[model samples]
Target: MITDPVNRFIEALHCFPALPRVFNPWFSVDPEHDASSLAPTHRIDNLSRYLTERLGRAKVILIAEAPGYQGCHFSGIPMTSERILLGQLTHKGIYPGDVLSGEVTRCSRTDGPVGRRGAKEPTATVVWQAIKTAGLDPRECVLWNAFAFHPFDTDMLTNRKPSSDELRDGLPMLHQLLELFPDAQRVAIGKVSKGILDKLDIPTSAELRHPANGGITAFRTGFAEYVGRL
Candidate 1:
């Protein structure tokens, strides 16, 4: 039996209904491309440790749109990449130590075209950089997404926006996280997240541009402003 609330939350991800073209990193493994049959289990362990470390300490929660193929789809941690988890990337003291705790293994094969170092997501780097730019401790913020799973239209490797139905489907887990950090201020990382948070009447402290699709500069500015207001 899972005793830890964080572990139970990690396990709850496996309960999400299997959707076509959607990938659940904690439950599903790509037969043709993943590292091994145990990749999903490894991801589950990694995320469990991450949330366990930050449970009641997070002061802010950053809600983004959804997990991208290059990020959480393999790492099992939202807005984080395997390379960053593995201590291969760093900037201004984020990641490696503050963002992730315990061991993090790559769910994707090292021999693939992404190379032996594993995939790195630019969005992950930019988001962490924004936190540092805002002069906030990375550990004080929890990175999440409206849709926790990776949704793709045709290719599992390519990222696509989650539909309204998908967003609604993800609410139970989203609410679960909020409950786990009841006092943390919610910050939407893009229009989609802000729209959903607004519609649900969930009070949000700030809404910043998503650091993807060429919005890094704007996101940094908004993040800094949000921190300044704190």
Candidate 2:
């Protein structure tokens, strides 16, 4: 019996629709990107363990627009990358302990687009930094995405905004996540995420600019003010 909230949440994620050009990190396997045949299972384990460690400790739910190829596509955790999970990259005050109790592994092929372990998303780095600046432990915050999958065009390496219809596929999992962390304050990281949250009647504590595309400074400023309150 999957009675654990984190386990149940992961089970729901496994049942998500397999949309075209959209990669479900917790289930999808890309020979071109994955390091081995077990990469998909590894991703699921990563997410399950991550959520398990933070269960009942989350104070905020940071919802971003969508997963990026260099970010959640490899890490399983939203707004996070392999480098950060593997302890290759660490922020000052955030993640002082092992992200997954020393179980983190590289799921991306070494020769993949970003090369080496896996590509690191600038936005992921900034998000962690913002958390550190807020003086909050990483476990106190749960990072999620409006569209939990990586949406792309013809090229798997590139990222694209998910259409409304595609975003609908993420609704079930999103609702499940909110239900899992009902007490945590919701914070939207971009306009798209904020719009979705607003339309769904989900109250959000803050709607800050995304740290990508030259919005670093603005995002840092906005995130500090909003997340600081929590």
Candidate 3:
């Protein structure tokens, strides 16, 4: 979905670091997990190695702040929120039953029950479900994040919004991700991405009123007319 010779594009990002799943909860990320959330051992040479090995080509790249404290920050998979994983399943091609049935990793975990507060952050299923609703293909969609590593989690345990300086420092990876999907139309998950879009001169829209906002009816009402054009 990006370009001819995907390796070359991945190679150009040789400076980036890749890592094994680091989400053990005891270990910390800094001075260890680089912006790529990868250990020092991982090289730029393996950029396409993981996803290419796992999912395949992704044309659309979804943007998010970073991983949840319990998810990728602990595990190293970008946007690895268990709630979002459930979302992907509910969408066509993937399902909650099949996921819990051991078809997928069964990573779904939530702080609160469904229809209540504290849903898991960005599980793969919710994302895929959103993509399905958006009328897009997962094989054609490449997923990544602004920081790739989660930075903030005090006693609150809520993921911190990355600072402007962090975003400024961490943005090159965003560019690399952009290069990974030349045809992808970027989507901003939260407010911070406006600056990223401004840096790249790409336009973005505001966050839609999410299901958490009782906006599900509006989503069903008008989303089809909007998604791909952005």
Candidate 4:
């Protein structure tokens, strides 16, 4: 049985059936095809352990829509991609190898070229950059998604917006996170996230634009405003 709250949280995510065919960083492993798929759990677990140590400290919770195929689907950390997983981001404390051994192969996307070592997702880059630009310490915040799992299109390579039913299923895990960090101020990172929070009756400190498509500038501006208020 998992005793620690952090591990238990991971366990809860592992058990949730957000989609019929899902890639769970906490439990699923594809050794032959992509061993790196197995590394996200370790990366996320290390992050949880760090957050556990910072319990009672003033923190912020940033909730986004859901994991992107090139982001949390592999890194297991929201607002992060494989580049961040390999310690390429300014915040290296959440590296996948921090708690696990062996080299993690950088898996290529279905539409991407092969042999890529550190691929980056545009959204991840923008989110992290916005966080840094806002003068917020990455360690002082916890990032998650309203829908914790990746929802793909028929191609399974392309990302699709999660359905209402899927988002509803993910509510329990979000609630579990809130139970663990009751004092942390919550911030929804997009319309979907804010809508879900509203449905759950969970109050938030702010709602920032999501840094995707052409919303990078708006995202940065909104994040800066939120940070300025802090």
The estimated TM-scores of all candidates read 0.92, 0.93, 0.55, 0.81
Strongest candidate by TM-score: 2
Candidate 1: pairs in clash: none
Regions of model 1 farther than 4 Å from truth: 91-94
Minimal lDDT window, size 10, model 1 = 90-99
Q: What lDDT is obtained when candidate 2 is compared to the true structure?
A: 0.81
* Tens-digit lDDT track of model 4 for 140-188: 6677788777777754345777788877777788888887788888999
lDDT tens digits, residue span 107-180, model 3: 22222232221134444434545556677544555556666545564532455666666666656766755665
Give, for candidate 4, the lowest lDDT window spanning 10 residues: 92-101
- What's the ranking of the predictions by TM-score, best on top? 2, 1, 4, 3
Clashes of each: 0, 0, 23, 0
Residue 109's lDDT within candidate 4 is 39
TM-score of decoy 4: 0.81
Which residues of candidate 3, in runs, are more than 4 Å off?
A: 1-50, 53-57, 82-119, 122-125, 199-223, 227-230
Cα lDDT of all candidates, in order? 0.82, 0.81, 0.45, 0.68
Quantify how close model 2 is to the true structure by its C-alpha RMSD in Å: 1.8
Better structure of 1 and 2 per lDDT: 1
Per-candidate Cα RMSD to the true structure, in Å, reads 1.8, 1.8, 8.0, 4.1
